[model samples]
Target: MKPRSTLVRILAMATAAGALAWAVTAGNQPSHAATGPVADAGPGYAVEDYGYPNADKILAEKGILLKCGDGYIVLADCASEQNLLRFLARDRADVCFKVTGEKGYLALELESVHGVRTSDVSTTHLEMTAENDRVTYDIPAKTWEGVGESADGREHTLVEIRTTK
Candidate 1:
């Protein structure tokens, strides 16, 4: 093989280095802003239908059993052992008394799913929020990964608490 000219080698090296740097920077950038007006970021997974007694019958009977946007709301099935209903109820009370007495929406995210059956998981990515004293949740995409009910009886993975303005 013949030795490449110095100019050619330097040019090739510079181009490779520049591409590498761009890739790293782009990968490190935040995919979405954490605290901003809720906007759909193309298509992705998120949590949805997050609230206390997240059922229609239960909500009507209990009369808003838990405050919106409070972390203490039992998002999962109440019959499940991993249910956080009691704990969330207590926390909701505390949060209600501490804040400006304004209603807020609670949001939850199932960050990742593991040791769970694929059949039990929802294919759609969900996003939930409470506004105007009503809980509104939506699925961002028709299909998503990393969401499923645990086979070992563990239901929820990641829970997030947020308030809507």
Candidate 2:
């Protein structure tokens, strides 16, 4: 076998170095809005339904149903970081949930996760109220972003939930 040319070796080394740098920089970036401390689901936190739908239509058509020890829990929609934050900030009735927009949008939702299900699938506007439970330092949306978590621990900053109503 002939030895590789000097130019080829140099280009290969440069490519490898660039890739390494990108990986390091990307890995160091923060993904989601600071969830503060994630409360453990605790014991008896059985999940009756926990699956991802392909599209908004599918999710809206076939929502995920979860049955905990307390009662049945239906997840109508779930989003990541900016979107979640936005949904919470605008739609959630409870004002205690607080989040700062930075680096990216905050994830949020107004879908029915608890209580009785609704027939209306139309998007509704959200309003901010006064309450205190989840709070964190305010950061501009351009300063931070969020990512979704997978079973394998992989993260995605964006996600869409679907279900059948």
Q: Which number leads on lDDT?
A: 1
Q: Write the residue-wise lDDT of candidate 2 on 49-77 in tens digits.
A: 43323436533554322112111112323
Q: How well is each residue in 19-74 modelled by candidate 1, as lDDT tens digits?
A: 99999999988777654545553556676544544445644544333434544223
Off by over 4 Å in 1: 1-4, 32-165
Which 10 residues in a row give candidate 2 its minimum summed lDDT? 64-73
Alpha-carbon RMSD, candidate 1: 21.4
RMSD of each: 21.4, 24.0
lDDT of each: 0.35, 0.31
The alpha-carbon root-mean-square deviation between model 2 and the true structure, to one decimal in Å, is: 24.0
